[model samples]
Target: MPPNPTSYDTASEMAGGPGTLEGMKRLWTPAWIARHVAMVVLVVGFLCLGWWQVTRAASGNTLSFGYAIEWPVFAGFVVFVWWREVRHTLRGTRTERPTPAPSATAGSEPAAATAGVRRPVRVSRVPVPGDGVQDGDLAEYNRYLSWLNANPDAKPGDYPG
Candidate 1:
C-alpha cells in the first residue's frame, strides 16, 4: 500500500525542499530587475572607461594606465555590491530577527555609546558604507559649504567627475 500524505510531511517538505527557491524566484520584482539592469549598465560603463583610458595611454598619456586599471576595479566592485544586495534582499527577512542578548562579556561586543549623542527615537535612514552620506549639524554643514566655496576645486572631483 502507498504511504499516507499528511500535513506534517507537506509542511516539512516545503520548509526544507525546493520551495526555498521561492524567495529567489520572487526576487525578480521591478526594483530587483532595475538593480540588475543598472548593474549591467555600470559594468559596461566601467569597461568603456577602461577602454578609453587604455586608448589615452596608447596616445601617450602616462596617467591613463592607472585609470585603465582603476576602471575595471570599479566594475568589479559594482558587481560585488550588486551580488551582495541581491543576496541580502533574499535573506533579509529570515535573518533580521533579533538574537538573544549576551551576558557578562557582552561589553566586548562594543555597543554604541549614547552618552552624549541624541539619537532619534524614530527610525531614520542609516547610510550604507561608500554611499558618501553626510548629515548632522547645520552650522558645521554651512561651514563646510563655505570652505568648499573658498576652495574653487572642491566640487565633483572624483574620477568620473
Candidate 2:
C-alpha cells in the first residue's frame, strides 16, 4: 500500500530524514518560525509582567503577590507547551482525529452496535398536542402542572398530587 500523505514519516523522509540538516531546516519554515517567535515573545512578556508584579508586591500591595506567582506560572506553561510541540514535531507524531459518527442507515446492525457501543440508547417519542393517545402518568403530571399554574402562590408541598 502507498504511504499515507499525512503521515509524519513521509514528511520527514521528504525533508531528507528527521536527524539530517534538511529535516532540521524544515522546522524553520515560515509557519514554524512565526510560532517560535510568538512563543519567545509570550514567555518574555509573561516573565516581565511577573517581575512587575513582584516589585508591586515588594511595595506592599498584597494582591500583586498572587499575580506575581501567577505570571511566572504562565511563563512556565508557555515554555512547557513550546517544548512539547517541538518534541512532537521531532518524534513525528500527529494529533489524533475524532472518529466519525456511525451511519444509522448503513447496515442491518444498530448504529450503536456498529460503533462498538455496548448498550443502545432508547429514545421515547414525544407526544404532540391533541395526539388522542395520552399516557396515564403523563396525564396525571399535566393535571398537577395545571393545578400549580392555577394556584401560583400555593407551596409545592400543598400540591395534592
Clashing pairs in 1: none
Best by TM-score: 2
How would you encode candidate 2's per-residue C-alpha lDDT over 39-140 as one tens digit per residue?
A: 999999999999999999999999999999999899999999988887677656333457887666755665553446476689879945686788899889
What value does the lDDT take at residue 154 in candidate 1?
58
Please report, in order, the local distance difference test score of every candidate based on alpha carbons.
Answer: 0.73, 0.81
State in Å the error of residue 100, model 2.
26
The segments of candidate 2 whose C-alpha lies over 4 angstroms from its true place after superposition are 1-18, 93-161
lDDT score of residue 108 within candidate 1: 73
List residue ranges in candidate 1 displaced over 4 A: 1-19, 93-161
Per-candidate total of colliding backbone pairs: 0, 0
